[model samples]
Target: DVKVTQSSRYLVKRTGEKVFLECVQDMDHENMFWYRQDPGLGLRLIYFSYDVKMKEKGDIPEGYSVSREKKERFSLILESASTNQTSMYLCASSLQGHEAFFGQGTRLTVV
Candidate 1:
Protein backbone atom coordinates (compact mmCIF):
# COMPACT_ATOMS: atom_id res chain seq x y z
CA ASP A 1 0.00 0.00 0.00
CA VAL A 2 1.13 3.54 -0.73
CA LYS A 3 1.80 5.48 2.43
CA VAL A 4 2.55 9.10 3.13
CA THR A 5 3.19 10.54 6.56
CA GLN A 6 3.46 14.07 7.84
CA SER A 7 5.52 14.86 10.88
CA SER A 8 2.76 16.68 12.67
CA ARG A 9 -0.97 17.13 12.44
CA TYR A 10 -0.97 20.42 14.32
CA LEU A 11 1.56 23.19 14.89
CA VAL A 12 1.57 26.52 16.64
CA LYS A 13 4.24 29.15 16.23
CA ARG A 14 4.92 32.72 17.11
CA THR A 15 5.52 35.32 14.51
CA GLY A 16 9.06 35.29 13.13
CA GLU A 17 9.65 31.73 14.26
CA LYS A 18 11.14 29.30 11.85
CA VAL A 19 9.17 26.11 11.38
CA PHE A 20 10.12 22.82 9.87
CA LEU A 21 7.55 20.41 8.51
CA GLU A 22 8.55 16.97 7.41
CA CYS A 23 7.03 14.30 5.21
CA VAL A 24 7.95 10.81 4.19
CA GLN A 25 6.73 8.37 1.59
CA ASP A 26 7.33 4.67 1.48
CA MET A 27 6.18 4.05 -2.09
CA ASP A 28 9.34 5.11 -3.90
CA HIS A 29 7.58 7.85 -5.79
CA GLU A 30 9.63 10.10 -8.00
CA ASN A 31 7.76 13.29 -7.20
CA MET A 32 6.97 14.97 -3.88
CA PHE A 33 5.18 18.22 -3.28
CA TRP A 34 4.25 20.72 -0.58
CA TYR A 35 1.12 22.80 -0.72
CA ARG A 36 -0.85 25.06 1.60
CA GLN A 37 -4.63 25.16 1.78
CA ASP A 38 -6.48 28.28 2.73
CA PRO A 39 -10.14 29.06 3.16
CA GLY A 40 -10.72 30.91 -0.08
CA LEU A 41 -7.55 30.43 -2.06
CA GLY A 42 -7.75 26.64 -2.04
CA LEU A 43 -4.65 24.51 -2.27
CA ARG A 44 -1.63 26.39 -3.57
CA LEU A 45 1.60 24.68 -4.33
CA ILE A 46 4.63 25.67 -2.29
CA TYR A 47 7.46 23.61 -3.71
CA PHE A 48 8.13 20.27 -5.33
CA SER A 49 11.05 17.97 -5.91
CA TYR A 50 11.20 15.58 -8.79
CA ASP A 51 14.45 14.02 -7.62
CA VAL A 52 16.82 14.14 -4.73
CA LYS A 53 18.54 17.51 -4.35
CA MET A 54 16.41 19.04 -7.10
CA LYS A 55 13.56 21.40 -6.28
CA GLU A 56 11.10 23.51 -8.24
CA LYS A 57 9.22 26.46 -6.86
CA GLY A 58 5.51 26.12 -7.25
CA ASP A 59 2.71 28.69 -7.18
CA ILE A 60 3.54 30.01 -3.72
CA PRO A 61 7.10 29.88 -2.38
CA GLU A 62 7.73 33.33 -1.01
CA GLY A 63 8.06 32.38 2.65
CA TYR A 64 8.97 28.75 2.20
CA SER A 65 11.74 26.49 1.01
CA VAL A 66 12.07 22.74 0.61
CA SER A 67 14.64 20.01 0.82
CA ARG A 68 14.80 16.47 -0.47
CA GLU A 69 18.09 15.02 0.65
CA LYS A 70 16.81 11.45 0.46
CA LYS A 71 14.43 9.71 -1.89
CA GLU A 72 11.76 8.94 0.70
CA ARG A 73 11.80 12.19 2.65
CA PHE A 74 10.91 15.79 1.95
CA SER A 75 11.08 18.77 4.28
CA LEU A 76 9.44 22.14 4.11
CA ILE A 77 10.87 25.17 5.87
CA LEU A 78 9.06 28.29 6.82
CA GLU A 79 11.71 30.96 7.11
CA SER A 80 9.71 33.28 9.30
CA ALA A 81 6.24 32.50 10.38
CA SER A 82 3.57 35.15 10.13
CA THR A 83 -0.11 35.28 10.92
CA ASN A 84 -0.93 35.26 7.26
CA GLN A 85 0.98 32.05 6.84
CA THR A 86 -1.42 30.12 9.01
CA SER A 87 -3.05 27.36 7.03
CA MET A 88 -3.21 23.67 6.38
CA TYR A 89 -0.08 22.23 4.83
CA LEU A 90 -0.21 19.06 2.84
CA CYS A 91 2.41 16.69 1.52
CA ALA A 92 2.00 14.42 -1.43
CA SER A 93 3.92 11.92 -3.52
CA SER A 94 3.37 10.16 -6.79
CA LEU A 95 5.13 8.32 -9.58
CA GLN A 96 5.30 10.09 -12.91
CA GLY A 97 1.79 10.47 -14.38
CA HIS A 98 0.23 8.45 -11.57
CA GLU A 99 -2.30 9.34 -8.89
CA ALA A 100 -0.71 11.14 -5.97
CA PHE A 101 -1.05 10.00 -2.39
CA PHE A 102 -1.43 12.67 0.28
CA GLY A 103 -0.58 12.89 3.92
CA GLN A 104 -2.89 14.07 6.67
CA GLY A 105 -2.37 17.83 6.55
CA THR A 106 -0.68 19.90 9.22
CA ARG A 107 -2.65 22.78 10.57
CA LEU A 108 -0.38 25.69 11.41
CA THR A 109 -1.34 28.66 13.53
CA VAL A 110 0.98 31.63 13.79
CA VAL A 111 0.28 33.80 16.76
Candidate 2:
Protein backbone atom coordinates (compact mmCIF):
# COMPACT_ATOMS: atom_id res chain seq x y z
CA ASP A 1 0.00 0.00 0.00
CA VAL A 2 1.12 3.52 -0.70
CA LYS A 3 1.68 5.84 2.21
CA VAL A 4 2.59 9.43 2.80
CA THR A 5 4.28 10.44 6.03
CA GLN A 6 5.11 13.79 7.56
CA SER A 7 8.09 14.48 9.78
CA SER A 8 6.06 16.20 12.46
CA ARG A 9 2.38 16.41 13.27
CA TYR A 10 2.76 19.67 15.21
CA LEU A 11 5.33 22.40 15.26
CA VAL A 12 5.89 25.78 16.90
CA LYS A 13 8.24 28.51 15.83
CA ARG A 14 8.86 32.12 16.63
CA THR A 15 8.89 35.03 14.23
CA GLY A 16 11.95 35.35 11.96
CA GLU A 17 12.91 31.73 12.52
CA LYS A 18 13.42 29.27 9.71
CA VAL A 19 11.26 26.18 9.50
CA PHE A 20 11.51 22.93 7.62
CA LEU A 21 8.62 20.59 6.98
CA GLU A 22 9.27 17.23 5.44
CA CYS A 23 7.19 14.63 3.64
CA VAL A 24 7.98 11.22 2.28
CA GLN A 25 6.10 8.81 0.05
CA ASP A 26 6.53 5.12 -0.12
CA MET A 27 5.15 5.06 -3.64
CA ASP A 28 7.29 6.78 -6.19
CA HIS A 29 4.93 9.42 -7.44
CA GLU A 30 6.04 11.89 -10.03
CA ASN A 31 4.21 14.88 -8.66
CA MET A 32 4.64 16.21 -5.15
CA PHE A 33 3.04 19.31 -3.69
CA TRP A 34 3.09 21.49 -0.62
CA TYR A 35 -0.04 23.28 0.58
CA ARG A 36 -1.06 25.34 3.56
CA GLN A 37 -4.54 25.12 5.01
CA ASP A 38 -6.09 28.01 6.86
CA PRO A 39 -9.47 28.55 8.53
CA GLY A 40 -11.19 29.98 5.45
CA LEU A 41 -8.58 29.95 2.74
CA GLY A 42 -8.66 26.19 2.35
CA LEU A 43 -5.61 24.53 0.81
CA ARG A 44 -3.30 26.99 -0.84
CA LEU A 45 -0.41 25.60 -2.86
CA ILE A 46 3.08 26.57 -1.82
CA TYR A 47 5.14 24.54 -4.27
CA PHE A 48 4.92 21.65 -6.72
CA SER A 49 7.72 19.46 -7.94
CA TYR A 50 7.45 16.94 -10.75
CA ASP A 51 11.00 15.68 -11.03
CA VAL A 52 14.16 15.68 -9.04
CA LYS A 53 15.41 19.24 -8.52
CA MET A 54 12.52 20.59 -10.60
CA LYS A 55 9.94 22.82 -8.97
CA GLU A 56 7.07 25.12 -9.83
CA LYS A 57 5.80 27.95 -7.70
CA GLY A 58 2.24 27.56 -6.53
CA ASP A 59 -0.42 30.11 -5.57
CA ILE A 60 1.25 31.20 -2.33
CA PRO A 61 5.01 30.83 -2.80
CA GLU A 62 6.10 33.88 -0.93
CA GLY A 63 8.18 33.21 2.19
CA TYR A 64 8.30 29.54 1.22
CA SER A 65 10.36 27.19 -0.88
CA VAL A 66 10.64 23.50 -1.69
CA SER A 67 13.21 20.84 -2.40
CA ARG A 68 12.94 17.49 -4.17
CA GLU A 69 16.36 15.96 -4.13
CA LYS A 70 15.06 12.41 -4.33
CA LYS A 71 12.01 10.70 -5.75
CA GLU A 72 10.51 9.84 -2.38
CA ARG A 73 11.27 12.95 -0.39
CA PHE A 74 9.83 16.44 -0.68
CA SER A 75 10.50 19.25 1.72
CA LEU A 76 8.87 22.60 2.41
CA ILE A 77 11.02 25.42 3.68
CA LEU A 78 9.89 28.59 5.36
CA GLU A 79 12.41 31.31 4.62
CA SER A 80 11.42 33.05 7.83
CA ALA A 81 8.46 32.26 10.00
CA SER A 82 5.76 34.82 10.75
CA THR A 83 2.47 34.93 12.63
CA ASN A 84 0.60 35.13 9.37
CA GLN A 85 2.25 31.87 8.31
CA THR A 86 0.64 29.87 11.06
CA SER A 87 -1.42 27.13 9.46
CA MET A 88 -1.73 23.44 8.74
CA TYR A 89 0.64 22.34 6.01
CA LEU A 90 -0.10 19.29 3.93
CA CYS A 91 1.98 17.25 1.53
CA ALA A 92 0.63 15.19 -1.32
CA SER A 93 1.95 12.88 -3.99
CA SER A 94 0.43 11.60 -7.23
CA LEU A 95 1.04 10.41 -10.70
CA GLN A 96 -0.51 12.48 -13.46
CA GLY A 97 -4.24 11.81 -13.59
CA HIS A 98 -4.02 9.54 -10.54
CA GLU A 99 -5.47 10.04 -7.10
CA ALA A 100 -3.23 11.94 -4.72
CA PHE A 101 -2.16 10.57 -1.36
CA PHE A 102 -1.80 13.06 1.46
CA GLY A 103 0.18 13.13 4.65
CA GLN A 104 -1.48 13.44 8.05
CA GLY A 105 -0.67 17.17 8.01
CA THR A 106 1.69 19.35 10.02
CA ARG A 107 0.08 22.01 12.14
CA LEU A 108 2.52 24.89 12.44
CA THR A 109 2.21 27.78 14.83
CA VAL A 110 4.25 30.89 14.29
CA VAL A 111 4.48 33.25 17.22
Clashes (backbone N, CA, C under 3 Å), per candidate, total 0, 0
- For model 2, how does the per-residue alpha-carbon lDDT over 2-90 read when each residue is reduced to its tens digit? 89999999999999999999999988899999999998889999999998899999999999989999999999999899999999999
Alpha-carbon lDDT, every model: 0.96, 0.95
Clashing residue pairs found in predicted model 2: none
Q: What are the runs in model 2 whose C-alpha is more than 4 Å off?
A: none
Best candidate, lDDT = 1
- Weakest lDDT window of 10 consecutive positions for candidate 1: 35-44
lDDT of 1: 0.96
lDDT of 1 at 51: 96
Tens digit per residue, CA lDDT, model 1, 5-111: 99999999999999999999999999999999998988899999999999999998999999999999999999999999999999999999999999999999999
